[model samples]
Each structure stands twice: as structure tokens, then as C-alpha cells.
Target: MHDPERFGAAGPAAPTAVAAGCTSTPRRLHHHDQQAYVWSRVHVNPSPSGVPGEAAQSLVPPPRSGAASVVVQDKLYVFGGYGGGTGRLDDFYAFDFRTCSWEEVQVLSEEKPGCRENNGVVVLSARDQSIILFGGYNGHRWLNDLWKFDIATQRWICLEESSPDMVNAMVNEEDETNAAGMGMPQQVVNASTTSQRPSCRFGYVSVVYDNKLVLWGGFDGQRWLNDMYVYDFGSSLWSQVQQCGTLPSIRSCPASAAEGKYLYIQGGYDGLERKEDFFVCSLDTYTWTQMPNLGRTPSPRYFHSCVMHSNKLFMYGGYSGSQRLGDMFAYDFETNHWSEVDCSSGDSPGGRSSLIAQVHENNLYIFAGYNGQTVLNDMYKCRLRPIGIPSPSLLNDFRRLINDPETADVCFLVEGREVHAHKAILAARSQYFRAMLFNGHMRESSDNSPVEIRDVSHPVFCKVLEYLYTDTVCDATLEVGIHLMVASELFMLDRLKSICEDLIRGEISTENVINILVASHQHNALGLKEIALDFILQHLSDAKIQGGLTELKSEPDLLIEILKLSSLQPVTPFARRLGNATQHQVLSPGTEQQPSQAQQVRLFNAHPAPQEQQPLWRVDWR
Candidate 1:
């Protein structure tokens, strides 16, 4: 039950006494059970009488069940519920609270536990966010197994016990030795300790209490249980506690609700009789006490659904006798009473039983259940207004990038345009850009006259225009790496410069070394030159010098430039190597000489090196 005051409902004036022989309610209950009972003052039914009846007539099909369900990061996950003719269901679905929609999620493998029903499922209360599923009826057999589904990885892992045989198998796989060769006894001991696990059980209700899982009553074929078990997730161990006071009789399908430190059980059938009596178990004291006089209590029912939302317990459709119910009600634990709610407007699902209900981001989700005869597949959402901050928009732009990679290029294009314009303006104001354009010319041809100039295109000419108009650099290939690197360096964009450097470095194959050296020289980038020289020196050892010389002889001028730059460096290992090579005249002997008229004429007439070399410089970096 919920606190009435929290929902603006008037509460009971005083705490009512329980029936005789009942112990005092635990102190934690006072926080949720202290308000006045105000059932008569509030209207439970908001809709007209005919609304639910009409909605029932328009019932849509529901997804199959015996499936596992859990919520993480405000999204509802429904995985592998029983389907194939009510036997076993391997289908997976997810509900987005923000969109009020449902989507099927695909698993990596087709292998799944056969059709199952009444399985115990609980979301791990850990930061890694996995959901645990335990024993249930898989059509043919009663399953006593444990499996976990990692929401992020979308994979299922079977949890196995640490037996000697299993330990030995793991050890053999990890170690390359036999029993006599086993390294240390403590190694096996440590392995056993880390592998210790919990026994598997299904059809149980598991709720988080003080961050531990408190598991209660579930059928295990041989018998129904009234026993209670606690699982410490941190320690991976299970312990049973001796609880005092009258406990709820052994039953399955009871709606269990948890708020703060107490677990509430209500409205389950005990094979022979349908029950209306409810009980609250305190985690702090390990005791159970009957809740008194739930005024206007829901009819004797089982397989009904109850979920805690904003401290109020909401009860939805379930079976009663031979009939299915569509009515919805709210139980106020604070006032020790129940009231009906009118769900007339918007959308309302028809009567459903064994349906799954979970709360995510203040919204309640009701998933697949049977309405007496038909299994429902449709999904419904109940919206709850938040208390403090306003609802946040679910459409985050950055998340859109991960979900839809195709849109990334378009998004980057738009953003890049703005960034490029800003960078161009900054480049216009700096000396770095001046150095790149030194002794170069950029002429707009009005007439076919060969233009001669030193550093044409003033920074101011394009700077203001690009800054105001947002001009984007469309050609962002390796060809543009040198230009972009120049601009990036001028604008102090180290990240962009690093990206350009990486692109240039990746293009430094032996065939492209001459082009790379020319670009590095044009931009006056010592870093780019160092990268090219190191690559050539590392790969071009004495064994490969014969093949490298053929390519180098064609670019004698470039080789001369490299030798001149190498000579200016202080004596380091690289300088010593370069000096030795220069002294030996590793390049063509006449490269440093003033050529004769015949050789000069041959150089002027030299066909621009192979087309392969020209296009090699234009390869796309990305």
C-alpha cells in the first residue's frame, strides 16, 4: 500500500489496531503507514462506466509470456517469454518509456531455454546492470537453473556451481599442466573461492532490500514454499533467516511490492482458496505481520499485478473466480486503505492476468498477459507526473549519432562548416598562415594571363568573407592534410593538427615520399619532415638501398633538400647516420653540382613523374 498524503489524498485520522494476536507493526512501516484513511473522499473511477467496457471490446493481442522482464536506465526489457503455443518463448522486446513504444530486440544466438512459465526474474542491483532469471516450468520440466542477461552486451550466461570436476576442467583449460604439475595448492583454493555460487530457484519473488535480494515463496514441483532466502550480491552467497510472527501461507502468483525496507505481499491463491489477506515483512527485524482491514479490498485473486509508483501501490487487471477484471485500483499503505481510479481518457488496456508490470522514469509499463482466454501482446503505459524537476526531452542529439551512423556525415558536415569558418578567421590573423603561403600565388582568372606573385590572397581578403559566410572545406582528403595542418597550427587547434599529421604519416609509403617531402618543405613543417625522414631511414636500410636509389634518382632536387636540412641538425645518432651517408655520396654523385646546359635542359624537359605518383598523393585519408 502507498502513503495517501503523497498523492494528495486525505489520510486516516489514527492508526487502527490489528486483529488480536497480531504483533506491533515494524517501525519502518510508520513512514508509509501513518496517514489517515480517505477512501470515501476520493473517486477511484475517473472514467464513465461504459469506457472500460468499450475498451475491452477493442482488445488487441498481447505478447506471449513465461518470458523474463527487467528495467535498466529507464528502459523496460522483455526477453524470451513463453510463446510457441504457450510452451516456451524466445522472443525479446523492449519498451521505451519516453516514446510510449515497443521494439523487438534480437539476441545473438537462437539457443534459449525451452518454453517456460512462472520463472523468477530480478534486475541485478549492481552498476553493471544485468538481469537474473531463475527456475521456472519449461513446458516439460521444472527448471532449477540460473542465467543472467547483460543488457549492454545482449548475451546470456549460465551461472554454474563450483564443483571439483568443473574446477578441474577450468584449471586444465587455463593451465598447461597436469595434477602433479599444478603450480600451487592456494591457486586452486582461490579459484574455488571466486567460483562459489548460489543455488538456482524459479517462480520466486525477489525484491531489493538494503541492496540485497530478498527471495520469497515459489513452487518447486515437490511442494510450494513459505520459506524466505536472502542473497548478498556483493558476496555471492545465500542465507536463510528465521522469521517470527504469522507468515503468508505457501502460495505462488502473489503480487509482491517493495518500498523502503519492507516487502508487501498481497492477493495470491493458495491452491484451495483465493486470498485477500496481505502481509508486510520487515527486513530490519526479520518479522512478518498481517496488515489490518484493507478497506474496500480487491476481490480474492491470483496472478494479478501490483507495482509501486511514487510510493503508491497500483493494482491492475487479474482473474477472479471465472471472470477477468479490467478495473484498476490504488492501495495507500500510509492510510491502510484502497481506492479505485477512473482510467477513462487516453488509452487503457483490457483485463489481463499474469501480465508483467515495471516502473521506469516515473512511468508504469504493463506488458503481455492473458485476459482469461486470449494472450495479449500489446503494451500500455501509465504516466506519472514527476515531483520536482520538469520532464526532460528524450531526443538527445549526441545519442542520435550512436543509434544512426548514416546521419553522422551530414551532422558533421553542418557542424564542420561552422568550425571551419571560425578556424579560417583565426588563421587570417596569424603569422603561421603567412609562412604557408610564402612565395605562392592564388589568382582569380578574369583573363588568361600568367600571374606572378609572392604570397597572393591576403588573410584579410578571405578571412572576413569566410568568417561571415561560413565557408566549409569540402576536400578533406590527404591532399588537404598539409593545408589543414597549416591552418590548424595557425589557429592553435592541436587536435585538428594531430589528425592531419596522422593522415600525412599514413600516406608516407616509399612511392609517395618525394610528394610528402615537397609538401613538408612548402609548409615549412619540421615535424612532417622528421616523420618522413624517420620512415625512410627505418625501412630503407643497406639491403633496400638499391631499390630506393632508383626512385630517389628521379627526385635529385628533393634528395638534395633533405641532405641540406639533415646537415644543419646537431650530432645525434640520426645526424651521424645522415652525415656518413652524405660523405659517401649515397645519392647520385652529381646531385649537388651545378649541372651543364645539356643536363639543365633535360631537367626542364623532364616529364612530371609518373601519373601513379600524382594520384598517390590524392588518396583519401579517412
Candidate 2:
């Protein structure tokens, strides 16, 4: 839940208004003492040396709003926007996450789009690596031009131009403020056009899906629109979509995101009112379904920035009409719930609107926007973390019940030592125990006398009993792990056997690698055997000092494996770079000694190329 005291100026008030070329002094929201923060601002290094870990600062893009930006290959490419005194801008800049630095993208083409703001932009295709632009305000009139910018070529190509009839209609308008109240040179599109493209407009939401641009809802100079359109990139055609179901009301500047087959729309102004209602549209069915106003609903707002990450929809600061809101909220698709993200910690991007927010990897970035007082040049970042309480672990509960005399319905006599155990737990955990205690004609099942286990030692049996109860083994050395692996195989507990194999593999050293290899081969621990072979191959010299070669020489089969593996290892550039020059050397008992044909057949009969298998526990056995 969110803290209400954090929102300043109390109850709803009249919406604030401001003029161009001047700052509107909107006060910052009050800070609260939150338990945990979900958002943290990234402090970039601004030093001339570009050294990291200095005092936190940013060398970023200039302050601007209504910019068109898109992320490609870990780089954020920002295009034109209104840069205050610089008026409308056509300059391009990119912020590289790898270097944590900004660079101006040099345009190679002479033909380019003029200075503009409030344009729609999206990545056309991953294969082509280009940005598609459409419809924006160029300070004087509304634009319906369609352009494409190739990131690799640093070139722009105009695909389509604005209809002259529509341009003339806005130019000859009587009331210049037709788009109304939100600023810029608003004009009504009183005259309709027979053009094959969408009419001149800006502030519409655009999403790329299936190589098509899906655009919905914006001001068309005359009135707020609720129409939907699809532009096919392959065919270069625009078509108005016939939508079904309860459609969203006419609105503009709503925070939106698209994932899979659905597009989500939330909170925007409808000319007369700001909305808090949320809606989703399916690209497949072309249907709009209003999402239930459940959980912690955000206040009515518009011009906010929204992004999708890890199946979550995140929204940041925006104007709530009455005041600018700094609060952030996330809607989870899996749970269908909304939760307020705590940003009270770190440097929060306090209360701003018209900001450009984008997500790359695990970080959410917000660039310049109007903070009421001024257009910000500063940039902020938040490292996204997983939300909700983790499911509780049952390890401790089961551990406490192990060998409890009160709950012991059965007992085991192993190596002349009494180990109390629950029959239900043992039977439920192991197939061997289930058959022995419940199904077979074993004397221990009929009588209440303890079952005699002569094969396993007492300590190994105790560890096995603990694993039956908790499905885990702890504080096990390499010796104990090998015994546990044998016990697991005997009881047919594949998961426990895999865990034991992992324990043995993790404790492998040049001194212990030969021992692990011997145990793995003896117990059919194939994955662990592969890891040991690779370890011995990588550190042959160190292992040889510990009688590693003597042990393998005694076992002719093991010696053949080492020689065959070493002979097969290719000395690639990567291997050479890692200084593994001896990867191709076949170190045998003697210089000329090699495995015979019968020994080669025996080695081939075993698992092929065990070194290729991963060291992790195999899921196939489970």
C-alpha cells in the first residue's frame, strides 16, 4: 500500500496551467519513510576521464519533452523533441549502457525530417535494425509524415508525406487551438481528406506487432479520438480497424504497453476529464476489455511514461491534473494486481510529466521531462527487482522431525546402531523403502522388529534418513557425499543421488579429483564423472604430483579415457587464449604406450564424450 501523506496539497484542486518559454513552479511531493524501495536512481559518472565509481552524476541529453525514443542493442536512440530555447529539435543522441556514456549520432543522409515533437516511433524489425517514425507536431502545424531511420547506416528515408489537403485544412483554420488546452499550435482538422493514410495528429500510442504498427487514440486537432488503425510495413498500407467490445473513451497521452497479443491502455485525459480506468485490446480479435479497477489503483493522470519488464507493467511520474505525481505503480500480469513501488530511497525522479521512460535489461531509465519548475536535463534510472513474498521453505520443519522418537513408527538396525525413523516418511520418499515396508513379504513389514541394513554404514544411513525426510543433504564432505550417492542409488532416490553427485563435483580439487572420478565410475554418476575427467585434463600436471597418473595407469580403462579425451580436444583460438596449450597432449603411462583395440572398444561402450555433459545435476534422472 502507498502512503497518502506523501501526496502534498491534500485534496483535489483545479488543474495547473503554464505558458511556453517559462517554468511552472509545481512543488515536489513529500517524502515518506518506506520500508523498502523498488526503484533506485542510477548515478552516472560525469568525470572527464570517464572513470567509474566517482561521485554520482550524469552527462546526458539536454532537457526536452515530447521526444521519440527507442532502444536497440542496449543503446537508447532519442530523436526530435521540444528543447525550450532551442525550439523544436532534430538532433539525435544515443546513450550506451555498456560504456555508460552519451554520443551524438551523426546523420549521413542529406535528406532528413525537420524539427518535430510528440511523434510516434518504434523499431521496425530486429533484422533490419531501423526506427519508424510517424505523425508529430513541428511547432507550426500537425504532421502525418512517415519516415524510417536506419541505425546501422545512420540514414533517414521518408516513406510517406503529409496530405496537402489536410495541411491546408489546418493552415486555413479559424480557431488555432483546435487540439485544445494541452499546448502547442493546436488547430481543428475541419476539412476531411481522401488520402490513404491517417490524418495529421500527434500523441497517439503506437506498438509494433507482427511487422505491423498498431496505433490507437489521439487528438485529431478537432476532438479527442478513440479510433484504432493498423499500418502494414510489408505492404505499406494503412487501414482503420473495426473494434469490438466496450472501447475506451476518446483520450490522448495515456501510458500504454504491448506484450504478446494484447495492448494495455491506462490513465489519460479525455479533454473534459482525466481518467484512471485501465483497458486492454487484443491484436488478434481487435477487442477492448476494460480491466477491473481493483487493488491499489493510481490517481487519474496522463502524459505519464509506462514500460513492460518481466511480465510487469511499470508506470512513473505524471501530471494528475491537480499536481505532478512522483509515485510509481506496477501491475503484474500473472497476479492481476497493482502495487505501488517504493521509490522513497535513492534519488527519486520527483514529480514530472512528459518524460521518456524505457527499459533495457534489468534497468528502467527516465530521461528529461517537465518538472513544473523547469524542463529537466537530468536522467534517472531504477534497477528493477522481483516483488512479492517468496514461498516459505519446508527444510527446517522436516529437519526437526528427523529421528524424533515420538514420531518413529519404524526403526533400522545398521552396523549394530539403532536409527529411529517414520515409516510413512521413508515409504513416501524412497521406492525401495515403499516396496520393502508396504508391498514385499519382508519379515520387517509383518513384524515390528527393526529392519537390518548391513550394506551401509551408520553415518551414511543417518544422512540417507535425513535426506528421506528433508530431500536435502547438508554439511557433507566428499567422502560422505560418495557414500550418500551409493545409498541414494540403492534406495532408488534419483533426486537425492543427483544432489550427492553435485556435492562431490563441487568439492573436486587436483588432490581429490582422482578419488571423485573413481567413485563416479563405480556408482554410475555419469555427470560427476564427466566433470572429474575435464578437471583432470585441465590440471594434469598438478594432478600427476598427487599420483593421479599412477591411479589411472593401474586402471587401463581410465587411462584410455584420458588419452582419448586429450587427443579429441581441439586447440581452438579460445583454448589458446585461455592458455590451455596442453589440451591436445595425450599424457599416458609411457611416451609410446597407448590403449589397445579391446580397451578402445570398452571405453567406447561407455557414455560417449562425457566431458560435453554439464556439471549440474541431470534432470533426465529426475
Candidate 3:
């Protein structure tokens, strides 16, 4: 920067600018991809320092409002605010959203100011990392002092001496590329009685745009303000700008969110009534233009939180005339429309006003504020959701429609249990039902009466009906799957048959292979029958040892089929491996059979082979 005239050279009479080894580098920040705000921070030591601002401060911060907070690199820095009953506080705390906890950062040097509210705190990218602070209120009076907290040193440098020098030190300081990043010995200052400096005021609005510190609008005890002030770093002066368009009246505590060159202002009280109007001010032309309400405009309120993300402004939780509100709304600048943000599902900050909300990495971090009854020190994070899904009750409502007698046109008697059902759904799912009902094959179709369903129990019938409505199987088991397979095969429901086949295949083991194979043969289920034979072939030796041979001996036809296959192959040794370990045998206490290795007999058990399962339904007739 070309600030050598204002910052580089200084005489002994001046507040000399000496270079330090501390410099903060600027980072490229984007806000599209944001993760959920899950983690919180915690202070390791809860003992109070017993100092004026430290007394009674535990792990949790003191209840306060009007705190100065800024978000940087997923961490929020909260400075002193007016704690309702506890007086003004000077405690500096940090809440790291990544860690999901808080840690009190005690300033080691005694040069720091006491606690106050409505102060301006912004991140500075000077050679040394520093947080810039401006005016605030400390209960009894207004404060116009400027302070600089050296991040590395953890010391506060009070800048109450000269306004011109402070302005130059802030907007004019150059990045010290030659020195190690730290602090300068001192900064030179010039007197500012020439042009009018900002008056002593609290409840002001401050924002950093293009490295320029802009301060405007505050409650100056005597009157609310509508004037604007901009600080020029190079010129080192505070100049009041003229406005051309319609402007908002004198008001304090309005929400100001910066997006590009425009600052969006929304809702604040004006001594008499709260406001729901919105406005935008251009920093380029210093013009104020009220934004037209095109969306669901919020009720008139004050002390709410507003943040800009993805071309949208989010406003949440504030106080109206009669009561506090927990609702949140989003206004899209491009669409010029408003929509409500549904924070009803997760943990919301809930009806709070006079709190601090900052946007970082697409997530909104809101800090403690006054929630009507008392002050708060809690932090709540909310992830931005882009899509909506059906609620749990919606699924239940669909299931209830099946049992509604007025909606249901057919009935079923399965295992002596009468069940109400919809003919349209049943006919749509099964060919048997469609043929019997729509084709007039059953007499019960004309009468709309319960028809007996043979070989199907009430529970299985209920599960089949549930799948028709929801396409999900609840609490599935082997016994229920076997029954469902039979019922599905009988009704010619291919989808249900496939689901039951998959279920039965998952339960196929040496102990149950025989039963599954016999059931598949009885029901003529080709898929299940194929999978069961493949299981027996892979563990041919184990299949015999597990009683598959005993079942095969009872069926001469099946035995002849196996013998014919064995004749073509000659040796079905299942050469891959058996119950014994083929590699390094680590003998443990128990002797359990190794069932995992007996997958298939690869003629060549190579080191890297394709993991393919053999099919069981490969039958041939000559």
C-alpha cells in the first residue's frame, strides 16, 4: 500500500511506527459449502480470575446483551457486553464451532478497557493480527475510545489519544513484508479537530468494506441519528457523506448485513413503534433506497439477527410489541421475495433479541442475548437445509388410509383374521388379485366382502399390504419371509417374490440350506431354488457333512441330477479350501469351523481372483 507518507516515517515527537514480526495474511473466503454446526467449545478452567470483569465468571459466560462478536475461520470472538444485573463486563471469550466449546481469553496486560455494549469489533488484516474496537456503552455513559487488541501478544492498545492517527493507523498501515509479523513500537497520530469527528455514541453500525472502516448511525443519548460517516485510511479523516434517495429515520439497533457493495438494513424501533420495513444503502454512491416488500414480510420488531448467505438475507428471532418471536425468514435479493425458514425440527436459538449472529462457512452462528425474561450466554448453530422431505406422520397417515373402511373397497380373511384393504392397491400389485377382482373370476368381488387367503397368516398379509403402501418391509425375519414368499408366489406378485427371495438367500446357511431348498422346490421359486443349489455346490463336502446329502438321498431324482453333473466334472473336491486354515494358523482358545473360506472351489485359487458366486439353477437335461 502507498501509505508511506502517513505510516512509514515518524519523528520522536510523533507516536513512531516501528515494525513487529507479526503480520496476518488475508485469505480467500467463500460461503457456498457449509457443514453442520455440531461441535462446541469449553473452557478448561472454570475458576474466576476474581478481577473486576472476571469475578463470578464460570465455564459459562455471564448473561449479557449488545455484545461485540465477529466470525473468523469458523471461530467466533465475543467481547464485553452489558450483563443485565451484573453491570458492564470486560471478559473476552471465544466460541469455536468446530470444537463446540468456549474458552475465556483473559488479556494479560492491564491496558484493556472495561466491559461495554454496542461497541464495534472487526477483524483487521494488518501485518500483525489485531481486532479493532470502537465506541460502546458502559451502563452509565457512552464511550468513543478506540482499542486495538494484538492477537499474538494478547494485549490491548488503547487508541484514545488522536483520532487522526488512529484512523491513519487503521486504514493506512502497510503490510511489513521485511519484518517478522508482530506489532510496531508505536503509531504516529495527527489531530482531527479540523473536520468534524463522529460524536460520542453507542448502538451504532460499523462495517469493513474494501479495507475501509465505515461508521454510521447511533444512539447519542440525546437523539437517535440518521447521519453517515466514512473513514478514509489514506487521507486519515472522518467525512460525512450526502445522501440522494429516501432514507430511514433516526433509529438504533437495526440489523445491517453487507453483500458486495450494498448494506441491507431491516427492522428496528423508532421510539414509538417497531419497524418491519427493509432498506438497502449503496456504499459507492451513499444513497438510501427502501426495499419493496415482495415476500412474507416479518412483523415489526427490533433487536433481531440478520445475515447474508448465497444471495439471501436471513432474519431470525426478535421482540415485537406484545411478545417475543421464535420464527425466522429469508429474503432473496435476486428474487425480491421472502420465505420462512423452518427451524422447527432442530435446535433453534429461540425467541431472542439483542443477540449477535455472524455468517462463516455457510453456517449461521448466533451467540447469547436477552430472551425477554433474562440474559443468555448460550450459542446455537443451525445447518442450512435446501430440501424438504415428508414427515413421519405423513407415512403413518398413508398407512391409516388402508384401514379406513370408507376408503377400502375390499376385505381379506387370512388365518381367521379379517383385514380391510383397498382393491385398487391389491389389484395393482398382484396379477392374481387383478384377475380375480377386475376380471370377475371371484364372487367376493361383486359383494365387496372378505375373501379367504389360503396358506397366508394375518401378520404376513399385513406386511404384504404395508409394502404395497410404503415399499418398505418392517421388522423382517426368516419365518415371515418364508411365509411371504409362499403367499407372493401364490398371488403372482413378482416384486414381493424377489424381496422374499433376497431375504431367504441372506439367511442361507449350512443349518438352514436344506429347509430353504425344500421350500423353494415346493413353491417353484426359481430364484431361491437357484441360490440354494449354488450354496450346496460351493460347500459340496460341507453340504454333505451338514446333511444336504441325507436330504438328497431321500430324492432319487435330485441324486441322479447331482450324479450326472459329477460325471461331467469327475472331481468336485471344492479345491479352494475347507474348514482348516490354509494360511498362517493362529490357534485360539475355541475350535470353531471356518465357514467363510468355503465360498467356492476355484480350480485355480489365485492370490487375486474375481469374487464370483456360483449359481445353483444351472440344470441340464440330455
Candidate 4:
């Protein structure tokens, strides 16, 4: 492992970058030819104070848009962008995640790229330890320059000078290749045979993979672009990439993020209008496939920002056609579903576009954007929760089967309504259905007649079918939970019974504790019964006031158990009197003298007023 101290500098003003140290010994970041063993990936290093953006409030970058951002050595570096009325900015800034502070980068080299916005920036490799920048608008004109900023030397070297006739040269080459080749498009042939640089463009998407920069879709000064190009860092050559499958539309300022061998692009402006389409390009075959728009997709917008973290693409605020948007959405590649994020959980940055976002240690940090009214330099950080393999229903692809009459073979006539269900699914999920339907015991199983369910209501039976098919229930209530618990017991769905038991347990209180205890005992809900019994034992004083003594007395076994359990624990004076009086009437304790009904009334009348007390578990005898 390389020492983090190697990147640290001595001065206060100069950029002091460090590779946030880990608790354990650091491992090789990348596996080269000499590297033999693979190292386990570690979580992103958290701030020393354990609070992100706490120290970043005072020192922040000036408001701007279309800036380029790249994360290196646990630090985020942001370059030039349009600074609203301040014009374009060429200043560079770096935020140290470890220190939670922003520092202006002091360039040692006098020569550097001019002020620009919407540029492409990436880190080619850890060994190079440099930032690669290319192509942007420089206020005066479009630029096609390539510059490398060395982190160790703190200097910028111009690898390729700004080209004035870059577009014309590329056009001439394409024309010649087409004229020489047979009636086929020569773009694909020239892509392999000829080496050429892309014309000057802004708002293009660029990502680094296998040490090569993949550039696609941007706006040249004249028109919107929809071409793909690759820059090999090893050969230092540029080549056009011929793609297959449905191509993404010609657009600019689209949100793009790269993961593994796939590049995901979504929402951009196509000169005519903004688009909300989604597409993915395979880096291996250069194939583009449009993903179906599914579930809570963001509106058509451009100049948005996206970052890939833990197999999910998080897209944040952008410019709609009419105004700026502040919404956040996440797209799951595994399930092909989009979900809106709850931005109200934290300090939201509000509506903005062209912001620079980078993921560090599972936290997404966005900085500098145009919010329609003004450019903003405020930085907002929100920790990202990994979008796991959706819910079980989505994972198993069975949720759609619920209440789908077209595919259902059995219909249950429940409480004056017909509830459709599949016999195969019901039989497979519950033993009650298997015996009643397939064992030749019921007439409804062999015939087309609907099965009559008299005991269960329509809503309750529907919840049962939902669990039978999808393995879960939605929006269960206290009333429904008690009825569902009874239905679950009748249907022999233990998992469903447990789920209902848990639901009813959460609703346990003095008002319903005894009733719940009686229902649990009647329905054989052992878990709920134990919990309810404990509740009554703990709150014996208040439970007595809830007036379930008649129900408690009905279940003589339950009442005796409550009395026996209460005898071993510390009790309030009122509880001791009640238990003793009830025990005398119920058990008739071995001819021992016991308080009569009238005497018990006198005993209660003579006792002191009930004082506020803790629950049985928390009660202190001393």
C-alpha cells in the first residue's frame, strides 16, 4: 500500500491532498500484472468528526454552472464553469473529505487551459495520479484542447493544443473514407482504420474504463451531436466507435454515469426539446439499448447530474423546459425500476441544474449549479442508501399475479363479492388450499363454481391472497390484524399469523391488552398470547380499569395463568388486592380464609389512591 502521507503537502494554502487512511492496513488499489492477490474493497473513509459538510459551510466555491468534477485520493476537485454575471471561471478548487474543508488549488505552472465550462474531466489511473481535461466552451469560442494536471507536481501540461479546424478535418476524412469504400457507410470502417480527434464540443458525456476515455453525445457550436468516440491513454489515439442497437437521441447536458461495462444516460436537451428517455450503452460491443421507462421517472430535463453508487444510478436536480427542478430519483439497474428519493430528510439544496456531483464513501456531494434565478455555490451532501435487490415480490416477479382475474383459475365468493385467485398458487403457498382443492374433498375444486368463504370478509380474504401470492400484506390495520390473525390460523399460514401477531403486538395497550390476550389464546397465536399476557401482568393496575375481567374470567385457564404469574412478581397494592380477590373466587385456595366479595369491596375502599407507577419490568421494589 502506498503511504497516504505521499500526497500530503506542508503549506496551508496549497492543496494538501491525502488518501483518507483506513483502520486496517491499506491494500493495492488496482491489480496490475505484478499484483497477484485481490484485496477486499472497503467502505469510503468517513469524516474524522463523523459529520459531513459540517466544516464546509464557511468556505465554499463561488456560484457557477457546467463545471467538471472528479474524485481522487478521497478529495473532490472542481474546475472551470460559467460563473453567471462573473463570467467564466478558470479557478480550481479541491475539497478534502477527511478534513471537511475546501482549499483553492495553487497551480505552479503558468501555462494552463483558459476559462471554460461543460468540460470533461477524469482520472486515467492511480499510477498517473493526474486529471485529464478536454473540450468545453471558453466564452469567446468552443475549445478542443487536452490538458493534464499532475497532482504531485501541481502543474498543468497541454497535451494537445486548441484546434481551430478540428471539425473540418474530421468531416473531410469521413467524406474521403465514404467515397473510397463501397456503397456502405464508411464511418464503421474508418473507425477501425483511421485515427482522428473529436471536434470541439460542450455538454458531452465522458467516462474512463480500461484506461480509455469514452466520449459520447454533446453539442458542437453548430448542432447537437450523437456520436461516440474513444481515446486510448496507452496509444494516445482517438477513434470513432461504431455502435449497434437503438441509439440514444442527439442531445446535450444529459445525466451520465458508468458502472462496470455499462454507461447509463438519461434526460437531456436535444436543441428542440428536453427528453426523459433512458438508455444504456455496453462498453464491450458499443451497443446501445433503450431501457423502458418504469416507476416514478423524473420529468424531461437537461443539465442534470447523476452518479453510480452500489449498482444504483442517483439522478439529481436539473433544468426542465419551463423551470429548474429539485427532485431526486434513483434508477435500479437490477430491477429496471425508478424510485423518487425523500429529499425532505435533510437540508435540500432546492432547484438547480448543471451541478457537479461525486460519490464518496456512499455520500453524494453536489456543488455549484444554476437555479434559474442565479448561480449557486452552495454544497449539499446526502448519504446514499444502497438499493438492494428490490422487495421479494419484485424479485420473484409474483406481485402482478395478485387479483389478476385473467390468469386466475379459482374465484372466492367472499362477503357479497368475488375475489379472484389462482388455485395453483394458493395450493403451493398454503396447506389448507392444497387439501381442500386437490384432495377431492370440496365440490368447488372439481367444478367451475366459485368457492364460498363465509367467515372471512372481502378485504381480509384479499389480504390473505396477497400474502399467499406475494408473501406480504400492505397497509394492515389493527382491526384487520386481529381478523387476519384469526383467518391466518384457520388457513394454517403460520408466517402470516406471525406477521399479524407482530402487527397486533405493536397495537397492545391498556384498552385492548386483555381482549388481545383472549383472542390470542382463542386463535392459538402463541407469540401474541405471550406478549399480551406479559402486558397484562406488567400493567395489572391499569388493565383492571380497562374492564376486561369478564373476558379474562371466560378463559379460566388464561385467568389462572395470569394469577399464577402475578404471584411471583412485585405488584402494586391495587394489583395485589385484585389478584388475591380473583384468586379466592377462581381457585378457592385449599380452604384457606379468603376475602369475600363484600370484604373485597371494603378492602378496595380502604386502600390509598393509585399513584403513578412504572411498568412491571421497570418497577423498583425498594
Residue range 147-213, candidate 3, lDDT tens digits = 6777788888765432323222222234233111212224423323334567656767777665666
- TM-score sort, best first: 2, 3, 4, 1
Which candidate should be chosen as best, given lDDT against the real structure?
Answer: 4
The regions of model 3 sitting more than 4 angstroms off are: 1-58, 126-128, 161-195, 387-622
The local lDDT score (0 to 100) that residue 506 gets in candidate 1 is 78
| Better candidate number, 2 or 3, judged by lDDT | 2
Error of 2 at 253 (Å): 0.6
Each model's lDDT comes to 0.53, 0.71, 0.64, 0.73
- TM-score against native, each model: 0.46, 0.53, 0.53, 0.51
Per-residue lDDT of 1-622 in model 2, one digit per residue for the tens?
Answer: 1112211233112222221221124565333322234454444444233347565343466667778889999888998886765666777888777766676787897667767777778898789888988887765677777777888898777776655467634464533444232222222222223345677777788888889888888776666778888888777778888999989998888888887889999998777878899999989988999987778989899878899988888999887876778899989888888888988767888888778899988778887776665666566778676344445568887888877778788888988878888888888888788888888645555587888986678998899988888877889977788777777877788998889877876887766677667767766767667878888777654423224444343355775567567556754332232222122233254566554645444443342331332232221121
Model 2: per-residue Cα lDDT at residue 339: 89
Candidate no. 2 TM-score = 0.53
Model 4, which residues run further than 4 Å from truth?
Answer: 1-58, 167-195, 386-622
Error of 2 at 395 (Å): 20
Give per-residue lDDT, candidate 4, residue 576.
70
Error of 3 at 408 (Å): 58
